[model samples]
Target: MLNYRNALRVGTASCLEETSVDVSYEDGSPDDDDVPRRAIVAVLPPDQETRILMLTTYLNLARCASHVGRNKDAVVCATLAAGIAQHDEHTDHLITAKILRSRAHLAQNHLKQALRDSAAATELAPSDHKSVQLLARDVERAKRAALRANKQLAKEVSTWVQSAQSKFAEQGGNEADCAQQ
Candidate 1:
């Protein structure tokens, strides 16, 4: 018979494994169903160790969400993980959460928020840590990419709106009414 602590760990790990397998089978696109919700519930045990495990699970879920273009969900999971890590005084998890959140923000074209999160992650990480340095570099790159993408998106949207207004005006419609429509 497993001890209570060990059982909790095993259960949490099992839940993580199940979710990862399910995510892999979906080719990086998470289902808009109950799998992630169930995983979150499964990992929420009351013990400290289990709480740490829950933090890990949340981080993993955030990564999965980011992978599948669910940037909003990724931000929510990463923020929850960061909050839990802060409450538990887990610096490593906190740093990971910040990094993940930064990436999610970048994916969502929130460049400023991504840069802020990257700065927080750098401040939280030890100066001598090589891995954290790499993470910071990656975040910087993502920020730059997001800036360029945002500029292009803005230009495209401007062109689209102009075209729409011209077409509406040619059809005897007012530009203001076309915008509302």
Candidate 2:
């Protein structure tokens, strides 16, 4: 009884839901950064290929954004994670996405956004849980640091702008003078 579009959507959704991740930490420390989630996802059945792929893809994209200092790229990865959760329904992925989304917000100094996402991740996370709890704590700490960072940058930029305005005023609002000094 499903319409063509609805069927396609459902099928695609299920297809994507098959993907997953590895969440194990070695001695409470991640053994590898490249595919930190590998250990967790690897334990799942071979039939869950999509879940594995999605998890890896999201993690890689997030790492890439960090390496490149690209907040937009990070946001895109987070968005993909949010989408994956629609069909995946696994608690882990949802928590991971929330953490990733929080990272994106933190990178851009969006404190409120970061706080909300990180808090969600921490709350929904399992007790005696895996990766989610640690990431949530990390993000929460980072959120506080980000707030300070934003305020510091705002102060610096404001000071610079104010100094420039004062210097320009001394020169009778001369554009050329402002540009020179």
**Candidate 2 least-lDDT 10 residues:** 1-10
Q: Which digits, one per residue and each the tens of the lDDT, describe model 1 over residues 1-181?
A: 0112111111222233433422221123232222342334233355898888888999999999999999989987887788678667899998999888988887776778888888898899989867568767877787677679889999999999899899999999998898688
lDDT of each: 0.71, 0.60
The regions of model 2 sitting more than 4 angstroms off are: 1-48, 128-181
lDDT of 1: 0.71
C-alpha root-mean-square deviation, candidate 1: 11.9
Decoy 1 TM-score against native: 0.53
Off by over 4 Å in 1: 1-46, 142-181
Clashes of each: 0, 12
